[model samples]
Target: MMRVGVISDTHLRSYDRDLAKKLAEHFKDVQMILHAGDITELSVLDMLEAPQVIAVLGNMDGFAAAQSLPAKRELKLEGFQIGLIHGYGPPNGLEERVRREFDDVDAIVFGHSHKPTNYLLNGLLYFNPGSAAGGRGHPKTVGMLTLGDSISGEIIEI
Candidate 1:
């Protein structure tokens, strides 16, 4: 199985020591790391210990480090097509907006709501790892995606 660690909305200006420790402990076995955005600093990626890192630039990321990062991306992992987006506008219609943005994707990973979500809608998985920085009263969390014969995932609260 392929294990991918998913994180988002880490609005820290510098490396977060607690977050680094948590990642090292919990994501030791992950093959890849996905940052859904709002990562305020590019150094955050350098601090992670994953073999591969895939990310997008969120609305709040305006620095040079985030300048070249795409706003959206599509990747295939273990034969499943996954769409990555940082999201926009209000949270109420966020899912619909994402669905409209990508087609033929098995799963859509997004952030910006700072709320954890793991559910299937119209046969597509909608996952939001919440805010890894614990912003807006939401608990700090991340996600794990296991791909094998099929795709399965979980939102983990840190």
Candidate 2:
């Protein structure tokens, strides 16, 4: 299995030293990191030790690079198809959105609600790591996912 550090919504007003240190400790052995978006600054990605980082642009990500990031993406890990998106529709319909946007993926990961969640539907898993940066109205949160032959995940607060 491959361990993935899942982070999202870090809208930094200034450097976050505590967050950096916490990430280093929590994601120490993660093979990669995935940012589901709303990253207002570029430096957030720079602090990660993982060489492979995949990110999407959230509504609040105002940097130049963020504009170019696709609203959605797909990735294959350990023979599992994974999808990433920043959902904006009603939280109740989130499962349907994942099903509609990433029909072929075995799993989907997203952020924007600033609330961690996990669900299984149509033989696929959908995950939201919430606001890893605890930006403004959100509570600080982050999670780690393990990918392999079978799909399962957990949400963590840090």
Task: Please report the candidate that would top lDDT against the real structure.
Answer: 1
What is the C-alpha local distance difference test score of each model? Answer: 0.89, 0.80
Candidate 2 per-residue C-alpha lDDT over 81-117 given as tens digits, one digit per residue, 9 for 90 to 100: 9999887766677666656887688888998778787
lDDT (Cα, 0-100) at 58 in candidate 1: 92
Q: What would the per-residue lDDT of candidate 1 be over residues 1-158, giving only the tens digit for each residue? A: 89999999988788878889998887899999999999888888876788899999998885865677999999999999999999999989998998888989999999999989899877799999998888777898999989899777899998
What is every candidate's alpha-carbon RMSD to the true fold?
Answer: 1.0, 2.0
Against the hidden reference, what TM-scores do the models get? 0.96, 0.89
Model 1 CA RMSD to the hidden true structure, in angstroms? 1.0
Q: Which clashing pairs does model 1 show?
A: none
The TM-score that candidate 1 achieves is 0.96
Q: What shift in Å separates residue 106 of candidate 2 from its native position after superposition?
A: 0.6
**Residue runs of model 2 more than 4 Å from their true location after superposition:** 135-138
Report clash pairs, candidate 2. none
Provide the lDDT at 52 for model 1.
96
